[model samples]
Target: MNLNLRHAIMQNISGNSQEELRETIVDAIQNGEEKMLPGLGVLFEVIWQNCSEQDRQEMVQVLESSVRK
Candidate 1:
């Protein structure tokens, strides 16, 4: 939950294969751990920085879906 751990996890994410990261994220969510949200926010920021307009819209959709749950 601390910023250090969050940064560490974000760094670790780059090392994970896509499937591994996907599983880790899914598990984190299923357990209802709010700390993961911050790290996910970081990931979203990283993606948004370079994402195209269409991708940004998709990201907003994803955010909306999460908020509705």
Candidate 2:
């Protein structure tokens, strides 16, 4: 079966408020399921696209720090 996963995930959460989105992210991370990774990636992609360069750099720094532990 063909699936546009990103599109489907985005569509599913399109109307979510900020709090709802935060809860979704928290739940996904807490669950730690492989299936949730793609959804988190899409969320990160949206955040990356919308953020400023400085914000992106900060995120990169955080990512780097996270992986070093």
Candidate 3:
């Protein structure tokens, strides 16, 4: 059986409202379960794919700065 996690995650969240999306992220973070990491990565992939180059750079910088803490 083929388990396509990224596609499945996208399907689960498709058509969600902005607030609903925010809640999903917030809930996932608060829970801090390892199983939730793939879904979060897929969401971040979608964001990276849609954003401009400058936005991508900014996100990278933000990630770098946060991880240094």
Candidate 4:
């Protein structure tokens, strides 16, 4: 059997508002469960695909800063 994770994740969150999306992300991080990682990755993929180049650069900078800590 095959699973389409990205499509499934998007469908699950299709109608979420900004507040709900934030809550979901915060909760996932706070919970620190490995299962949530792929979903976060998919979300980040969506953000990366949609965001501007400057925003992508900023995000990479933030990640670099976080990793150095």
lDDT of candidates 1 onward, in order? 0.80, 0.93, 0.92, 0.93
Tell me the tens digit of each residue's lDDT in model 3 across 3-69.
Answer: 4987799889999999999999999999999989888888998999999999999999999999999
- Give Cα distance to truth, residue 33, candidate 1, Å: 1.1
Model 4, stretches more than 4 Å misplaced?
Answer: 1-3
Candidate 4 per-residue C-alpha lDDT over 1-69 given as tens digits, one digit per residue, 9 for 90 to 100 = 125988899999999999999999999999999999999989999999999999999999999999999
* Candidate 1: clashing pairs of residues: none
Q: Give the C-alpha miss distance for residue 18 in model 3, angstroms.
A: 0.4
Q: What are the runs in model 3 whose C-alpha is more than 4 Å off?
A: 1-3
- Residue 20 lDDT in model 3? 98
Candidate 4 collision pairs? none
For each candidate, how many residue pairs have backbone atoms clashing (under 3 Å)?
0, 0, 0, 0
Say which prediction, candidate 1 or candidate 2, comes out ahead on TM-score.
Answer: 2
Candidate 1 error regions (>4 Å): 1-6, 65-69
| Per-residue C-alpha lDDT of model 1 across residues 29-49, encoded as one tens digit per residue | 798888678777676677789
TM-score per prediction, in order, is: 0.66, 0.92, 0.91, 0.92
Model 1 residue 35 CA deviation (Å) reads 2.1
Global local distance difference test of model 1: 0.80
Task: Report how far residue 63 has shifted in candidate 3, in Å.
Answer: 1.1
